[model samples]
Target: MNIEWFLVLSALLFTVGLIGVIVRRNPVVILLCLELMLSAGALALLAFSRMLGNQDGQVFVLIVLVVAACEVVVGLGLVVAMYRRRLPLDVDEMKELKG
Candidate 1:
């Protein structure tokens, strides 16, 4: 497989995720976009790590997975809390939680 193609694909995926994050107003959709971005980053890291014959990137992917899991758990917790308050899912309407 061509490494350049992998890199390009990852870039495109990340770009789409970023665009989604910026354009979407819903917190849940934004969280999904963040996950997409994270997966794209992991894909690029794994591809380069494979090209260089290194296991370090593979280990780093485990860390990314853990972080992503934590992010989802926390994000969902916030979303659920927001819902409990009978608030809209729109990000702009979440000002009450702000410090």
Candidate 2:
């Protein structure tokens, strides 16, 4: 596997995820996009690790996965809380926290 191709693929995924995060209005959609970005990052890291025969990249990917898991748990909790408060999933509808 050519390292440059892996890098390019990762860049493309990251760009798409960025667009999703910026263009979407729903909180859930943003979270899913964020996950996509993270996955692309992890894939790039894994590729580099394999190419270089280093364990550090894989370790970093593992750490990222753990963090992403935590984010999902907390993010879903927030979504549930929002629904309980009669809040729409749309980001523009959230105004209770504003001072």
Candidate 3:
């Protein structure tokens, strides 16, 4: 379809993810929102790649997928550790990771 349609969809997906990240308190929810944002970025990349008839976009999408998978693994491990320690799933508490 039209490139504009693809970009609009991607923008909408990113917006929803941004809202989720801002409005949700739970760490898991935040991670999922971040995933959504990543997915949107990948989608846009693929769409543009297809529009331009290049293989590079598809390669970038594959890299994004690997990164997203790694992100989920690390993010879920942290969340599970927090739960095991009887901590609330609050994303704000993650500030302790700053050090």
Question: Model 2 over residues 50-89: C-alpha lDDT tens digits?
Answer: 9999999999999999999999899989999999988888
Relative to the true structure, candidate 3 has a C-alpha RMSD (angstroms) of 1.4
lDDT of each: 0.93, 0.92, 0.91
Q: What is the lDDT of candidate 2?
A: 0.92
Model 1 vs. true fold: TM: 0.95
- Among residues 3 or more apart in sequence or in different chains, the pairs in candidate 3 whose N, CA or C atoms overlap within 3 Å are none
Question: Candidate 3 lDDT, tens digit per residue, 20-67?
Answer: 999999888889999999999999998999999999999999999999
For model 1, give the 10-residue run with minimal summed lDDT. Answer: 89-98
Instruction: Write one digit per residue (lDDT tens) for candidate 1, span 18-92.
Output: 999999999889999999999999999999999999999999988998999999999999899889989888987
Candidate 3 Cα errors over 4 Å, as ranges: 93-98
Question: Each candidate's TM vs. the true structure?
Answer: 0.95, 0.92, 0.92
For TM-score, candidate 1 versus 3, the one ahead is 1
RMSD for each of the candidates:
0.8, 1.2, 1.4
